[model samples]
Target: MSKKILISVVGPTAIGKTKLAIELANHFNAEIISADSRQFFKEMQIGTAAPNSQELASAPHHFIHHKSIHENYSVGDFEKEAIALLSHLFAKNDYVVMVGGSGLYSDVITKGLDKFPNVSPDIRKNLNEILKKEGIGPLQRQLKVLDEKSSNSIDLANPHRLIRALEVSIGSGKPYSSFLNKDKEKRPFKTITIGLQADRSIIYDRINKRVEIMIDKGMVEEAKKLYPHRILNALQTVGYKELFRYLDGEWDLEFAISEIKKNTRRFAKRQLTWYRKNQDIIWFDFNMSKADVFQKIDKEIITVQNE
Candidate 1:
């Protein structure tokens, strides 16, 4: 049997993953599957930086703006849907490119998800109560003590993720991290991971510039349209949350924009930390030319095929 390759393009936000993925997909004659959680929402175009018309035209992309903000979408859901799509795509082509900065979503498509014992719904309910009453800090601190690795990798600001982790820890009497990298379901195809990276200073600058561009691209107006749906999990992201604060009179526009830039930089740092844990990734500088990147990916694919 022939082997299909899923070429995953992963990196921090604003690190040019989209550009690189398009080039790779076009060169390899493959379609692109997006694993970016924020980019999945149809209402979060500007803020999430969903591909522009031109970029989308460059190559066929899937899973972008495929869900509504009001819908309940989870990593598990993405995994199943993406795998289904890949099955169809792989039947027609041996190579498919997956791109996104979302580590867990990407892992579901590439490394497979970890299994966990069932936790009572009451546990999740109680955790939500705690989050509502006390905010995310207590849950974060608790997770840090119980599962430091999860705390490091998770988006601490996300109430849904924090509550899920806490419920598992409380119900199973074991840290969440203990459940990871175990019982990973094997996939039929092989994955070749390519990661983009840069110095901290360069990454931070790129994030800042991207935030400015988002704001200029009417991020505030976009957030306003979704402000009524602010309580949705999709709106809990960095750019929208900051602008929602501005709408709430918590901060002025300038201050809110600054907060967005700061939080985005922090998010990018966490993304880098997550990707660094995977030793299989072949890293490339963010500024590497497209031709050079294609050369590297070509070499990596050849190595995988020969093995």
Candidate 2:
């Protein structure tokens, strides 16, 4: 029996990962499993840069818009469901492609989820109270003090992520980052990770353009509809959060759009910071031609298969 391969296309947001993944899936005669946590929610289509109808029809895709914003979906849940789906996929195809910008979720599939000490519910309760009384600012400052590394890498804008890190840091009497990348679960398939990257200026420019396209595609209207559910964890995203502020009358639409661009740039930087730590990823310029990229990935696949 031959071993299966999981080719992961990963990089910063708006870096053409979805296009590359579709092409690879078609070349390899495989299906795609989305590791982008934000894309899993059905309500966040326009803002999350989810594959459109044409793109979804281009290849067999899994895990995109499979959950609702109202549902509680964790990385652990994703790991279980994705692995099961992979087993079913591998039975029919020798290769499968996984793509996303969510580093933590992707890591769960490739390198097992990290184990953390049990945190007391009271600690999270206290943190939520603080967030309610003040805002995410104080909690952000506290995490910066407790786990500066995590502060730089994780999405600092997400309150659920912030609270999770704080509770673990406080409960375990150690930095939250101290618990990461400590566990490895051997998988049944060989893995190849391809990363797309570009100059910081180019990446930021792409993000700015993407945000504009989203706004033009009625992201504000989508946010307005979901604004009533603003407190949901799924709603705690870059694009929607900014528009939520606009809807709250805290900022005008222009200012909100600018903040969305600025925050998205920061999110892209953090994503690169996270993926850079993984030495196994093969990096490529985002503008590389499809044929050239395909050649390099094919060579890698052959090398891994022979090993």
TM-score for each prediction?
0.96, 0.95
Cα miss at 58, model 2 (Å)? Answer: 0.5
Reference-based lDDT, residue 210, model 1: 93
Residues 1-307 of candidate 2 have per-residue lDDT tens digits of 6679999999999999999999999999899999999999998999999999999999999999999999999998999999999999999999999999999889899888888889889999999999989999999999999999889777777899999999999999999999987857899998999999999999999999999999999999999999999988898889998899999999999999999999999889889988988999999999888899889888887898788
- Candidate 1 Cα lDDT to native: 0.90
Q: Pick the candidate with the highest TM-score.
A: 1
Output candidate 2 Cα RMSD: 1.5
Reference-based lDDT, each prediction: 0.90, 0.93
Ten-residue region with minimum lDDT total, candidate 2 = 149-158
The pairs that clash in candidate 2 are none
lDDT of 1 at 276: 82
